[model samples]
Target: MAKNDGKVIAQNKKANHDYFIEETFEAGLVLQGTEIKSIRAGRVNLKDSFATIRQGEAYINNMHISPYEQGNRFNHEPTRARKLLLHRKQIDKLIGESKQAGYSIVPLKVYIKNGFAKVLIGLGKGKKKYDKREDLKQKQAKRDMDRAIKDR
Candidate 1:
């Protein structure tokens, strides 16, 4: 898959290890005032964030955008359930896929594009323990091969 556009703020690296990402979509975020500033300063975390379609609308939860240091009492909450702007058809597709057993909507990464904060959401299926182990083994083997080639 291609990389996300613009300056990437945060990424959930564990998502790939814990689940198999079947599809990805770039969705805009509905951010408050200081939230956008925090995002521009790279103070966002997507580690435990997930997406859900509620009442036919997409929302992201557990994504943390640190409050701006200089903000007053109106600073946005650090971890709030933010709305994700997605097309109706895309939301429908995600709803259908996520309804299947062991499937979920995971937030993969956050980035800024055209001065807008965008999130990359993925449709992922839970991975078995053996699957994770196999992926680790494959990664280690690739690393070893690359090292061997370098030393040759």
Candidate 2:
């Protein structure tokens, strides 16, 4: 992935640890010039960021794009909601799935891909407390097995 001039700027590792992702989609962010510059400088935060389908379009909320240092009054708002560019069909599908049961759209990662700011959105279901405990046990068991094999 290095040769593509695409650097992963930020990742929401908590999303993965808390939810069972059912699907993922790559989305193009509609960003202002200053926002783009700030993102390229690795000043974006995905924590507490989530996506929602509104008026037949997907929007990302609560993602923070720090202001461009040299930007003046035209600088974009730091926590203003941003629109996500996704296909109409994809948006409809997301809306349908999200409305059913316990599904949600979460921002999984933000990266500069091919000179553009892109985000990976995940469709996920929240995990229960017991599920979280099970996940921890599984991780520990895997680590123990790996260590035992390495020492043999």
Report the poorest 10 consecutive residues by lDDT, candidate 2: 1-10
The TM-scores, one per candidate, come to: 0.97, 0.92
- Residue 136 CA displacement from its true place in model 2, Å: 1.1
Q: Give each model's whole-structure lDDT.
A: 0.92, 0.89
- Per-residue lDDT over 95-122 for candidate 1, one digit per residue giving the tens place of the 0 to 100 score: 9999999999999888988889899999
Off by over 4 Å in 1: 1-3
TM-score of 2: 0.92
| Most accurate candidate by TM-score | 1
Q: Which number leads on lDDT?
A: 1
Clashing pairs in 1: none
User: Which residue pairs of candidate 2 clash?
Assistant: none
The digit string of per-residue lDDT tens for model 2 on 111-145 reads 88878898889899999989999999999999999
Full-model lDDT, candidate 1: 0.92
What local lDDT does model 1 show for residue 21? 96
